[model samples]
Target: MLKRFVVLLLCLLLLAGCDQPIKSGELEKVGLLVPETINDQVWGTKGYKGMLKIQSHFNVDVYYKEDMNSEMIVERAVEEFAQKGVNLIFGHGNEYAVYFNHLSEKYPDIHFVSFNGDAQNENTTSLNFEGYAMGFFGGMVASHMSKTKRVGIIAAYEWQPEVEGFYEGALFEDNEVKVEIEYVGHWDDDQGAILYLDKMIDEGADVIYPAGDGYNVPIIEKVKEHGLYAIGYISDQADLGETTVLTSTVQHVDKLYEVVAEEFDNGKLKAGNLYYDFSDDVITLGEFSSDVDKEFENEIHKHIEVYRETGKLPNE
Candidate 1:
């Protein structure tokens, strides 16, 4: 009778252990917050596409709120996702980093991710886009395709790292290259971008590069109207003007999202900073126009090879 009692007690203990909650690496739900609408076809769209890829791959429940520019909206969205028991939350831009830092500690069970920003807390992780390298690629294409040896860039702001990188890359290609710069003070200032583009064209800038978010559209239109060569940024604008547009620098955000999701599933997601660049195949150049010669294409590939091997730009 005592032996029977001992066996029953052991079975009861095993059942109690099975009832205890176990934390696994399996992800169920995810949330995304974007500052602009998903239809922007650049920054916001790329993020939306990444979320969709994540959803398709993991079959996880994903929710997102676009055009969330205000702090209150961001906070509320984060709170709602937490309430909904999301395993992870992603802020598509640096604008949401502050909120992620504040809420991450309160919701220790959930992971907070910030794109294009630095991590501020233990529960938060960040992925920074290498804008400078992207600019370098654009400058290389522009310099190689310029006929007048005068390449111009119309940027949203002065002293931006990406703009500086473009100038450096142009100079690297040809020491005698004349590079012009103009700052429009805002990313979406169409009037200012057009005025500066005119000034650049008048100054003998045959190859123009626009390094702003929404400013590329107007500049590309002007480039087509003027029959000048232009290099695109962010998304592929070659379809915008087939012959006039040389190529574009593209950000492969879907790859980054895949890495994050795989890491989370493997229980390797940690709070820290993650850097991605040309070496990681995160920042890349889009399809080159047929106008680009074989020799120029070979030269561009050679530089890319050097960057891949050394993990540094030519001018770095």
Candidate 2:
């Protein structure tokens, strides 16, 4: 009986030790993998800002590698971070989901996070942005402001969710508003984006919304050169074309990173998918340009109040 009691006590102690949470300061190293140049002032720059926020808030060491476009480079960067004993590995785009899903098992000790992705794994957490809401906001603005009764969207690909939201929102605002959508088949195709922008302009689209990652640069420039109205995405791109860009649907990635970092510090971070939208205030529209009239701004504010009250967008 004495020997059996001792054995039971030892087992309980082992279990307790095994399940211990990490100490507060022990999780000190963070790694970020960015697929593009951090100065794009859009997706990549937002991610870089998020990393800086994490570093400042958590007082942790942060390391990052930009322009990790290929699979090999991504794999190599992740492995290097893991070998260096990083507490968390943040992959800053949907493209990193595949690699995170595969590598999380190999590095069981570290947590993996995929931004704007749907990756699910034992050690991985995915975060998807509310792109639909962004589109809806832009569409609303375009619908109200388009003098030609026609607006346009040039997307990187035919992702139906965002595209559909833009379509629905435009028509919801004014059923007579015609929205033209064109997919350039790639994210960074300046020439293709320009070609589509010209086509849409030729079709009498006065307000053009470009939804590609960095392609907005050329599209905004084209819209300004052609004296057309434009909507920006991912960041406050109003400065990209001062008078042309009416507003932008900004993604507050730094806030997302802050939330994640706080949860991690408290040992409350879980492996699953987390979503952010307008309801959470992580997704928002930038300040309206002076070109937007007070009445139109009030109308948009009314819709925002409804969304806030119901936790749903207009018609959603």
Candidate 3:
């Protein structure tokens, strides 16, 4: 009996020291770096939510540093994380990927993941969503809901995959719907987005989608002020007013983090590019808002049904 009890105690100790991966028990230490504050409620906030989801599910320790843009600052932040023996590091924004990739090369022992940029190194990986698929669905929804047959898009930058996705989605449903696109040149410039959106509204735009930073809140609110409907991104819960949020192209960041954490824990982690498309159900559509007409909303719902069932919508 004494021998059996000693063996049981040793087994318990071993089990306590081992982690079951991203699921739970024996937390693993991971670090996350962001280009902006999580309060941005757009891209940066999405990243924060993803990290939080990972923590909630798994026995994982997470450390975060936000509001870093410069290469030098990011480099220092990553280095500090490495010194602290963090097993995995996440660079939240696309702009920070390049620097993180460089650091990954210098410190091959660490595993690094980038949300936007392409993953090129053996020690680093990239994960991205297929914005085009979401954009296509958004366009279908906008086309059916627009009373004026006019929809407008406000993008923070001209070159991002997300911007292109929005453009393609809007144009897919009706080629003649008069979809207009504008670039504000900065990610956080809500004021610029509002100026552009107001101009489009004057031109008879009844629905506007702005893909800027946290400032998008102001732009959407401005649209509501003019009695126009608005769309959101990253998720559908974005509330600017009563009956606000026509829908959203939500990024399944929580799922991404959970899968990546599992791979890291299982010791099968590899450096490569990871892409999730709408067809894969990683990017999803939210509910249409009250501002949309019932008849039009039904039309949009039909398309959503197609997306849910067939994973494809009619051409934008």
Candidate 4:
């Protein structure tokens, strides 16, 4: 009778464990907080893609909130996720970094991660990609394709790393090339992009690189109107310009998440800010769709290969 009682209690214990909210021991419930709708395809969408990659590789129960525009909305979303007892939370944008760090402190037991993290917190880990490498590659494309040797860059913001990197890359590739920069102030401002595009075209810029999100539409139209080549970001948007797009700087956030997920699962979550630079292969350049000169391609490939291996480009 005692033996039967022990067996029954053990079975109940197992069942109780199985019924727990987050999987016991190793398995965890993961929550991803995105700044915008998953269709944004610029930043928020990229993070969602990362979340999907993480889910596919690991045994994790994932939850996400989309189209969160305001900080209050983001805070509420994080609180809601906390109430659901998520073990890990991914705040998908740099703007959400401080909020995520704040929430991580509030809920001390949970692990928090921010993409493009700028905050420093004990319980929070931030991941940022090296945009300079991407910019440099883009610069090379612009330098090679520009008939006037004059390139224009329309940025979402001056503070964004990609903007800084773009200039740095362009200068590194060719300081003699005339590069004009125009900040659109916001990611969604099409009017701002149009204003810059008009100015650049009037100034005889044969090539333009649109770094802003939906704001690229006006720039694309301008590129068509002026019959000029343009570089694209986020997506390989060459087709959108009738083959005028030279190349794109692609951020594989999904692949990045896959790396993070595997590391966390293996108990390799490092503390503090984690920066993925050019050497880490975190940022990559898309294929040049233009009829690139064979000699220029070879030269660019050689330089890229050297940079990838040495983590430092020659002369720049």
Candidate 5:
């Protein structure tokens, strides 16, 4: 295992330079930044809810700035928070990671928290969800629920863990299943997403997973028009259509905010990057649709329980 040891040593050396120490400060005031409005029923909404939880839990004043995708806009919002002496700031998405990294040195007293991206500053932390586990479960549901023995997935980027998890999970459930995955290349490209949807439909895909944040709602609505099955991503989308949505892979962003606030309040919050998983109750599957029978649901739960205890999914 000398080769493996050498590789591990190199990786550790690479990380050592950027993994600076963090010190948790008082939970006096907090600020949140979202790229879009909180009414989107997805990522932004979850973050808003999380901020509210932090506000209620800590009894501190919380401020939020929407429409923060542009660097200029984000810098302005952060400057405002800095001026107000906000101690902890949450950037709703990975897009804000760079801006936070660049500003961390300037705002030495403020600690920044964001999701799913590169975070290296001593005052910055990235909260990445272990999404593949939930994706595996969603894939199993889609494969088992699929009638044509063909399934499809639409995602913004191939780098997403859920896409591969769904692919493998489908095949694990049924070796004969055909799985097609399409990338829209951009998160908000609704037209491109729909075109991919049409192509998947034409190819006899009966169960689909739309895994993008900005366009999942419209894609699910279109999936309903075709009377097909879908596995919702990031949030509980059963309200979209109970019959069409088999289940949802959920990320409980609000709970995480509470946890972070609690940690900081208790002087336990750390920096660099923190990962949340099924065991942490952060990444999970939402309630199944009525279409999912009790027997199949129980089987999925059994697998999830085993994973939670043993850290090994069915495929492993």
Candidate 6:
């Protein structure tokens, strides 16, 4: 395994280190780098759909590489796409932003797009969603539905804006509500997330938010098996069960991909960090489950409307 790693690393380094000038226009060819398989039913799948959307509507060829778990693999994907004259590459997760920034100077002609991070180079663009609003509303649902007045969130990291949003939103809805947060160390650790879920349930949590993209589905399934409620994350998960999910905090990343394609088409695409929120319709709350109280759901909608119109959340 080490020998293979060394060989792959050396090959990719050679490919990327070559002083190849642009063989194509800035946006003529597009590439997508996904951290996991495209069939994961959440983040990666959304990313793949976004790539397809760009291909269908824009006058560009699209390429994708999945299961990007290592620095070597990432470099290999980028180098492979670069060889194909892909001057524009989209890293489907924030995990790629730093790597993109690192490669920015080396590949000055390549433009990189990724999520929720700072871009240090003129060739990199960081896309952020106003996740706080959705998290806050999700918190409200958890608090409202919890007979135990305790909720939990299994997040991959503390830097995620939605974690803070959910914490504060729960308290805002009910000051007595207790919120538990545990990180599974990374995005795809389903077993670790399950352990955290078990701990939360034992600690009196009646509702939980499984916020890790790859592991959330299994965690929600566990929540259902435990006869608890959950505030779904990333995708609309109300279909999981009628009473299992309260409301899903949806991030329509596919639509954001279309936005990027449109920007490229219109010659407005550039390097920088850009944020989208409820007003842009990028971050949203999905349909309320049948178990969600009608009155509480109405209140949540009112809060969303006020925030959309005035750019102020209730806690603000």
* Candidate 1 local lDDT, residue 120: 81
Give one digit per residue, the lDDT tens place, for model 4 in 139-233: 77787787787889999877667766666666666777789999877877888788888898889888888887667756876797778988778
* TM-score (C-alpha, index-matched) for candidate 6: 0.89
The CA lDDT of each predicted structure is 0.82, 0.83, 0.75, 0.76, 0.90, 0.89
Using lDDT as the yardstick, the better of models 2 and 4 is 2
Indicate the residue-level lDDT of 281 in model 3: 64
Candidate 6 per-residue lDDT over residues 117-213, each given as its tens digit: 8888888999999888889889988888899999999999988889999999999989999999998889999999999999999999999999889
lDDT of 4 at 293: 72
What order do candidates take by TM-score, descending? 5, 6, 2, 1, 4, 3
RMSD of each: 4.1, 6.7, 3.9, 3.8, 13.7, 12.8
Q: For model 3, how does the per-residue alpha-carbon lDDT over 1-316 read when each residue is reduced to its tens digit?
A: 9999999999998898785533433236788888779777667777777788777766566888987888899889878887887868888867766886678878777888987687788888888777766776676667666789898888777765766666666666666777888999887876777789879988999878777655678887787788777778776655666466678777777667777887887777668878877655667777667766788767766776776677675652
Order of all candidates by lDDT, from best down to worst? 5, 6, 2, 1, 4, 3
Q: What is the lDDT of candidate 5?
A: 0.90
**Model 2 clash number:** 0
Best by lDDT: 5
Candidate 5, residue 257: Cα displacement in angstroms equals 1.2
Q: Candidate 4: which stretches are off by over 4 Å?
A: 1-27, 171-175, 239-242
Candidate 2 stretches greater than 4 Å from native: 1-26
TM-score of each: 0.86, 0.89, 0.84, 0.85, 0.90, 0.89
- Evaluate residue 29 in candidate 6 and report its C-alpha lDDT on the 0 to 100 scale: 84
- TM-score of predicted model 4? 0.85
Model 1 quality (TM-score): 0.86
When summed lDDT is taken over every stretch of 10 residues in candidate 1, the lowest stretch is: 21-30
Better of 2 and 5 by lDDT: 5
Task: Measure candidate 3: CA RMSD.
Answer: 3.9
